[model samples]
Target: MRAAEIRLPGVAPVVVDREVPRAGDGEVVVEVVAAPVTPLDVLCAGGKSYFGVPRTPYVPGVQGVGTVDGRLVWFPTSAGMEPGDGSMAGAAVARRSDLVELPDGVDPVLVAAAGLSAVAAHMAMTWRGELVAGEQVVVLGAGGVVGQAAVQLARLAGARRVVAAARSAEARTRAAAAGADAVVALDTSDHMELVGRFLAACDGAADLVLDPLFGVPAAAAAHTLRAGGRMVTLGASAGRTCPLDAAVLYGRSLRLLGYTNKELTGAQQGEAVGVVAGAVARGELVVAHEVVELGEVTGAWERQEAGVVRGRVVLVP
Candidate 1:
């Protein structure tokens, strides 16, 4: 098997011949069909390691869609505070418990695109955030994988309204396709006016705010929430520090939730995967994934790290 691996921190991944990983008891050996270069993967390539300091000379991918014993499957290769040699290869090994059977009839690329993003979005909204049907939601950074997935999940979960805020027109388009009731462009000339307009479009303040960007966007998102609304902080794409008025939070009876799949237990991972996989089976959610040949892995990593690409980029080994 040929696998693309990071030799060390801050180094470009190289394609090298290696043995196909063997499945241990309660594990499965998968032939990787499509593996996406995610932000996390790019981060690893940059040297700042997570999922532990890469047992050096190992694969870098954190998730992928592939075939296990001829059955379509997908799984989170990054298991905990430690990383696994993931799917940036022709074949890889994965724990059976960490894998989910891909729904029948779904394209492999789409499944690859959805990957951990869908499962994490489902977990945040349903498990950590306690989302309920008929509530209104404001999705910040609605362009990214997790953001887009949240839009679909919120809609499918029956949110009364979904407002999507994206940095570009293309992102807004994708968000709308995912079922946002309204889309707000982040580059609008009038920042506060745009914020006000977004709230108005939702028919008032939102009942829930799905936030990825912090800083100004996070602060603005707080204003969009109705009295007693909840703000779920899933990622900090924008600056980390966000200033807030204590009185405003108290007055509105607002709640702030911080969510991450890394915080979940093994059981929680299974439940979250079930929710997302079920939704995929029903055609309620779609993730845009592009599968490139293994040799194109470097270009894919560059694109993902630069944040210039739309949707997820998968590498087919």
Candidate 2:
């Protein structure tokens, strides 16, 4: 089997030949069709994540779209977070329970690109953020996969308006393409300026906020929320610590919640993946992505880590 191996920590993966993995009890071998180079893959492989330093010379994909027993499915692997080869190869082992059967007619590359990022966005907005129809939404980090998905999913869930904010001009453009009612720049260091921009874009206050970037963006978005509005944060790409005003919480009685895919059961993950896949199949949802051959994993991985890629990078094996 041809696979991308992370031979060293903090290094990009290189294509290498490896033995085909054999599935064990409760596991199956998925003939990987497409695998996404996600941030988790880079973080774990870098040996700097909370997951701790992973065993070296391992495959690094966390999730992929593939087939088992001729049934198309989306599967997850422990990979860089644990001692196992992952879906970045032509064949990878996955627990049967972790497989989510994708909807018919969906593109494998597209589903693989969206993968857990989309799942996180959907789950956070609906389950954790308690988003409701006819309500306004504000999405932070709207350029990333999660943000893009949230922008679209909020509308699908009946949000009256969706406001997006991102730190870069390219990101802002992507957010606009995702159907956000208004796009605001997230590049400012002044909290009040960001809050004012958000307020203006939302035309008042939002009912729900899907926040992936924390730090100033989180604090600013919080100020643009209506009384009792909910903010669900899944990642801290911008900063780990937020400078949220204490008065905002008390004055508005706002809700601040954390979300992670780790908290979801296999059933819950599968259901969310199914929803995302179905939406993609219906042409109602899409995320910007670039597909590269599995052999070019090194360059693709480097590009993604350097933040040069415009969207998710999917490796087709």
What's each prediction's TM-score? Answer: 0.92, 0.98
**lDDT of candidate 2 over 68-148, digit per residue (tens):** 888999999989888989999999999999899988778998898889999999999999888889999999999999999
Q: Which residue segments of model 2 deviate by more than 4 Å?
A: none
Ten contiguous residues with the weakest lDDT in model 1: 75-84
lDDT for 253 (candidate 2): 99
- What are the Cα lDDT values of the candidates? 0.78, 0.92
Backbone clash pairs for candidate 1 read 51-82, 51-83
lDDT of 1: 0.78
- List residue ranges in candidate 1 displaced over 4 A: 50-52, 79-84, 188-191
Number of the top lDDT candidate: 2
